[model samples]
Structures are given as C-alpha cells and as structure tokens.
Target: MSGDTALVGCDFSSAPSKRKSIVLAFGRLVQDRVVLDRLERLPTLQQFGDWLAAPGPWIGGFDFPFGLPRELVEELGWPTDWLACIRHYCAMPRDEIRARFAAFCDARPAGQKFAHRAFDRLAGSSPSMKWVNPPVAWMLHAALPLVLEAGVDIPGLHAGDPSRVALEAYPGLLARELIGRRSYKNDDRAKHTPERLIARKDIVTALEAGTSRLGLRLKLSHAQRDALAEDASGDALDAVLCLVQAGWAAREGPPRWGLPEALDPLEGWIVSA
Candidate 1:
C-alpha cells in the first residue's frame, strides 16, 4: 500500500433504491487523522460494482460480512475454501438461500436459532446468515460477487488488485466502544429524535478526540461534521465509521491489515475487530 493511497468506507445496501442508496465516505490518512474528503451515494448495485472496478490505490472498509459462519457453511455442505464457498453461496437464488438458512435455524434450539462466526461474537455483529432484520445475508449475496468481479484484494481472504484492498468492517463495534450502544440513527423518520442526534454528536466528539482504541482522530470541516451528525438515517456516519477502520488498516498495511494472523480463511475476520 502506498502512503498516498486513498481510503474509503462503505455503508452498503443489498437492494438499493433512490432513498436507500449505498453510501461511501472517501478520505485519506494524514498522520494520525482521517481527513474526510466527500461522500457519494450509489443508488444501484451496478454503479457500486463499477465504482469498485475503478482504478485504485484505495483501501476500503465495507460494512458487510465477507464470509459466513463455519458451522453454517459446513452443515449446509457448501464449499470450504474462501473463494469457492463465496462462488457457491452467490450462485444460489436469494429465495433458495433464505430457505436453506431458515431450515438450518429451524432445526436448532429456540435460543440458538442462528449459527454465528466467532468474529460475529467478537464484533457484536449479526450473523451473516440472517435473512431478516438487518438482512446481512442478502447483503453478502448482493455485494461480495461485485467485490469478487471487481478483483479487489481482500487481505487474508482473496488476492487480486493489490492497490484496491477490501476489508470487512462493522461500524457498530467502534460505535459501541465510544457510546455503549446508545442508538444513533434510524431509517424511520418518525423515530429520529433529539436523543439520537445527541448520540451522533457524542460519537463525533469521541472520534475527534481519538478516544477509541483505534487511536486515530477524525478531521471534519464544520459542514462535514454537521452532515455526518445531522443525517437521521446514520448511513453517512456509518460510512465514515467504516472509513476510520479502513484508515486503521491502511496505517497497519500488508498481509494482515490489522486482522488476526490466524484468521479462519472461511470465516474471514473483520478489520480492527
């Protein structure tokens, strides 16, 4: 990775539309600060894929699971290798994938309906196989194929474009570290209250102070800070959060990218988790 490379953070959507587009935060790491450059929205997956394919010397933190639970993949009799399993998983129709995952959940005990990757517990993220609520499985289904087709390098997972590094990122992990799960955003406009606004400001304050374990401060102009903290949906803020993780990875660099050295190839680890 070059020292002058761009850094990106993505807040992705499985089925994007005009109102619920995929948000991207573009920045660069300068010393210990991540300087927010601009924000862009892709209202279609085709655009997202095209953007991924663009010439890069960019490292990105994408808010989506790069792999599934080992137990789930094994029980489902899917391919074990990283790229092969992703291909197999991606080839199936969403309906079929949901059916398989639902069946897997049905067979398990009540409290343990979902099988989780170890990283899920570590990052406090939803199971990648979950088809509802957050619908992360659909996200993996929609996004990973594009990442693969773009030939972006996923450190400790896939090797392709060395300049375009992709790492799994969970914004909630960093948010929880600073705020302990205080709700900061919502898609439902009715639920966008002062409390959530305050939460966003608090997070921004913590990040500006470099209070998180990542030890990198955020540099935002007055307008940029307002844009991040004022968006009721939190999509923009989440993208910036992922950008912070991407900054951490870019700073650390190379084969590990701040990932654990012994990461399970099948269930890829999240960046900075």
Candidate 2:
C-alpha cells in the first residue's frame, strides 16, 4: 500500500435517491490512524459510476456483494467465470431475478432457503442471493456493472486499472465486533432512539481507541466525530466504517487486499473477514 494513496469506504444503495443516496467517506491511512477527510453523496447511479472511474491512486471498500454463492450460480446455470457471471447476472431484469431466486429458495427446506457464500457465515452477512430485507442481490445487480464499467481492479476477482482497487466490505462485520449486534441505525425516523445514538458513539470511541482486532485507530475531528454519531440513518457512519476497513487493507498491503489467499475467485471475500 502506498502511504500517499487515497482511501474510500462507500455505503451503497442499489437505487440511490436524495433520501438514501450512496455515501462515500474519503480518507487516508497515516501510520496506524485512518483520518476522516470528507464525505460525498451521489444521488444517482451515473454519478456513482463516474466516481468509480475517477483517476485514482486510490483504493475503496464498497458495501455490496461482488459475487453470488457458487451453489446459487451453479444451480442457475449462469456463467461460472467471475466477470462472465457478473455480466450474465446483470443482464437480467429485476423481476426475473426475483422469480429465479424465489424458485431456488422454494426448492430448499425451511431455514436453509438461501444459498450462501463461504464467507457469509464468518462475516454475518445476508446471502447475496437474498432480494429482500437487505436486498444484497439487488445491490450486486446495481453496483457490479458500474464497477465493471469503471474498469477498476477487484483484487482476487478481476484485474483492471492497477491504481484503482475495489474490495467487498460489510460495515455490519466491524459494527458487530464493537457493538455486539446492537442496532445503531435505521432509515425509519420513528425507530431512531437514544439507544442507537449511544451505540454509534460507542462505535466511534472504539474506532478512535483502536479497540477492534483491525488494530487501526480512526482519526476524526470533533465535527467529523459528531457528524458520524449524529446521523440517525447510519449511512455516513457506515461509509466511515468501511473507510476504516479500507485503511486496514491499505496497511496490510495487497495482492490479496488482506483477504485469504485461497479465496474462491468466483465468490469474492470481504476485507478483514
């Protein structure tokens, strides 16, 4: 990892809007501290794609599944090659995707409906094939094309511009480690409460103290810390969580981006999982 390279952590929405846009935390790693530099919002997919293509000596951690489960792909008879698989999956309409995935689930027994990536259990992530709740499959649908179109390298999965790297990230993984399954955010204003606010503060304090296993402190100005804690939706804070993960990856240096060397190329691994 180059010390001077920019680092980004993104909280992505498949269909971005003014109310829930894609959020990016721009920062850099300085020794053991990941500094919070700024935040940017893209309210449309095109702008998000353009941001991905922006010339970079930068690496980013994006909140979306980069691949489907191998079992799901094989069952659907989609292309098994990573890029080919993504292109095949992306070419489908949303309804078709839902129908097909629904059928896959219907064939399985209760409690074993969604096929999962190997890393899903370790990372405590929803199955990438799941279309509701988190709708990570839809997230994959919306974001992978933009990433592919931007021609950025995806470490274990694909090679593109060497200067720009994108890695799979889940803020929940780090949040769980620090806060222990506590709900720190919600999109619904009615659900936002004092408890969630305290959870956010706890997360920020832990990150600043380098309390998590990643061993990297978060450097934030007073304003930045308040901004991260006070955002009830958690989008900004989630993006910064990813920034911390990206910073950890930068420190680890790559070819693997801190992922295991034996990762299945067709099913991407999350950073620091």
Candidate 3:
C-alpha cells in the first residue's frame, strides 16, 4: 500500500436503474487527511463493473458483504474455500436462493431468523444472508461476481488482481459514531425534512474538522459538501463514509487489505470493524 493510492467508496445497488442506482466516492489520502474528489452514480450494474475493472492501483471500501455466515455455509454444504463458496452461491437463481434462505429463516425462531456473518455483528450491519429488509443476500449474489469478474482482490476472501484491493465496508458503522441514532437521510420524499438535513451537515462538519472518532479530516469544496448534504438518498455521503474507512486503512497499509489477521475466511471481516 502506498500513501498516494486512490481510495474508492462504493455504495452499491444490486439491480440499479436510471432513477436510483449505485454511487461511488472517489478520493485520495494525502498525509493524514483525505480529499473527497467527486461522486459518480451508475445507472446499471454493468457500468459499475466496468468502473471496477478499470485499471488502477487503488484501495476500496465497498458497502457490501464479502461472505455469508460460516454456519449457514456449512449447513448448506457449500464449499468452504472463500472464493469457491461465493462463486457457487452466486450461481443459483434468485428465486431458489430466496426460497432456501426463507426456509432457513422459517425454521428458526423469531428474532433469530437470519444467520449473520461475524462482520455483520461487528460492524452493526445487515446480515449478509438476509433476503428481505435490505436484501443483502441478493446483493451478495449480484455484486460479488462483478468484483470477482473485475479481478479485484478481496483480502482473505478472494485473491484476484492485486492492484485493486477491495474490502467490505458499511457506512452505518462510521455514521453512528458521529450521530448515534440520528437518521440523516431517507429515499422517501415524505420523510425528507430539515432535521435530517441538519444531521447530514453535522456529519460533514465533524468529518471536515477531524473531530469524529475515525481521526481523519475530509476536505471538500463548498459545492461538493453542499451536494452531499442536499441529496436525500444519502448515497453520496455514505460513499464518503466508506472513503474515510478506506483512507484510514490505506494509511495503515495492512498486508491483508486492512483486515485483521484473525479474520474468518468463511465470514469475511468488515474493514475498520
């Protein structure tokens, strides 16, 4: 890892379209600080994959699960090897995958319907195998292949094109540190209000001042900050949150793509968890 490597934060959508889709935050870490360069939104997964495959030595914090629960994988008789397991899981049709996950949930007690990857609990993120709510199960199915196809290295999970190191990241983990229990954004137009806007401003301000627990300041143009604040979907801000973690990880220069040495391969760890 080099200090000057570009960092990317991906806020992903498995099935994206023109109205609302995936967003990326591009940045560069200089000294002890990170500069949020710009935001890129892609209308389709193909476009996102193309961007991922585009050449560069970069470190990325992508908002998606890299693996499923170990217990789930074992019980399902899936491959134990990280790359093989994900590749097999991604091969199934969406409906069959949903049925299997739903059956697993139906067999479990309420409040324990989902089998979570270790990183999910560690980062307070949605369960990787969840088929509803956030539907990360489909996300894993939809996005992992693109990452794999792009040849980006996923630390303990998958070895690919080492020039691009990708790590699991959840923006909520960083967001909660600065504004606990405060919802900063909503896709629903009816829910967008002054309070949420204020929350976004507060987050941006804390990041710019280096007062957040992440210990890295973010520099952005006034218009850039304003654009992030005004977006009701919060995708741009979420990408920046991932960028912060990526920048911190890049500065550390961990050999395993910023992941801890003891991370379980069956249930990959989240970056900055």
Candidate 4:
C-alpha cells in the first residue's frame, strides 16, 4: 500500500435521491491519523461511478457488502469465482432477485430467514442477502457491480486498478465499539434528537482522541468535526467511521489491502470487522 493513498468512506442508499442517498467522505491519512476533508452527496449510483472514475491511488472503505453468503451463492448455483459471482448477481432484475431470496428464506425456519456470510457474523451486520429493514441485500445488488466496474481492486474479490483498492467496511462495528448500542442518528426527523447528537459527539471525541484499539486518531478542523456530528442522518459520521477503517487497512491491515491472507474470496471479509 502506498503511504500517501487517499482514504474514502461511503454510506449507501439503494434507491438514492437528494432526499436520502449516498454520502461520500474522503481524506488523507497522515502519521497514523486520518483527516476527513470532504463530504459529497451522490444522488444516484451513476454519479457515484463517475466520481470514482475521477482518479486514484486511493483506498476506500465502502459501507456495503461486497460478496454474498457462500452458502447462498452455492445453493443458488451461482458462480463461485468472486468476480464471476458478482457479475452474475448484478445481471439479475431486482424483482427476480428479491423473489429468489424470499423463497430461500421462506423455506428455512424462523431466525434462519437469511443466509449469512462468514464476515456478516464476524461484523455483526445484517445478512448481505437481506432485502428489507437494513436492505443490505438490495444494497449489494445496487452497489457491488459499480465497485467492480469502477476498475478498482477489491482484495480477495477482484483485480482491477491496483492503486484504487476497495474494501468492505462496516461502520456499525466501530460505532458498537464506541457507544455500545446507544442510538446515534435516524432518517426520521422525530428520531433525530439531542441524545443522538450527543452519541455522535462522543463517538467523534473518541476518534479524535485515539481511544479505539486501532490507535488511529482523527485530525480535523473544529468545523469539520462539527459537520460530522451535526448531520442528523448519521451519513457523515458513518462515512468517517469507514474512513477510520480505510486508514487502518492502509496502515495496519494485511499486505493484501488489509484483508486476511486466507479470506473467503467469494465472501469478502470486512475491514476492521
């Protein structure tokens, strides 16, 4: 990994619009610390792809699942090769995909409604194939193809632009480390209250203080810090959380772009999960 690679984090929405969409945060890592410099709103995935094409020598932690559950992939008879499986998945109609997944879950017993990737259990994330609630199933359906087509390398998954390595990031992992289930932000205005703002503050304070096991602190102008906390939707903060993971992967993650050597290629691991 290059020492000067830029770091990025994104919070994705499956059906992005100006009202609720993807949020992109990017910055540079210096001296074992990260400084978030910009936040961008991509109202659509096409625009996100356009932004990704701008240029690189960057490592980004995307808040989306990169691969499906190996069990699900096998049961569905999808290709097992990382890139092949993703291409096959991205080619399906959303409705058909939903129907298939629903059928898979319906046949299983309760609590087993979803198939989990190894890293989903490890990261405490919703199953990548889950269509509702967090809707990460749709997120994967919506995002991974773009990541693959962006020509960026996704370690343990696909080979593309070596300088632009994309890693699966879960901000909840970092948030859980900081707040222990204290709710931070919500899309509903009613849910965005003082308590949530304070949780965001505490999470930011700890990041700036280098209190986490990653030992990486954040460098920010007061304005930048405030901006991260003030977004009631938590998208900005989540992006920053992913930024921390990206920084760690660049600095301390395995030589394979912060992924484990023996990682399940068809079920990419989450960075810092």
Question: Would you estimate the TM-scores of all the predictions?
Answer: 0.99, 0.99, 0.97, 0.96
Model 1 regions more than 4 Å off: none
* Candidate 3 Cα lDDT to native: 0.87
lDDT of each: 0.94, 0.95, 0.87, 0.87
Q: How high a TM-score does candidate 3 get?
A: 0.97
Worst 10 residues of 4 by lDDT: 252-261
Q: Provide C-alpha RMSD values for all models, in order.
A: 0.8, 0.6, 1.2, 1.3
lDDT (tens digit, per residue) of candidate 3 on 6-37: 89998888888877789999999988789998
Could you tell which candidate, 3 or 4, scores higher by TM-score?
3
lDDT of 2 by residue, 1-273 (tens): 777799999999999999999999999999999998999999999999998988998989999999999999999999999999999999999999999999999999999999999999999999999999989999999999999999999999999998998999999999999999899999999999999999999999999999999999999999999999999999999999999999989888877779998899999999999
Tens-place lDDT per residue, model 1, 185-251, is 9999999999999999999999999999999999999999999999999999999999999999988
Give, for candidate 2, the lowest lDDT window spanning 10 residues: 248-257
- Give Cα distance to truth, residue 156, candidate 3, Å: 1.3
Q: Model 4 misses residue 219 by how many Å?
A: 1.1
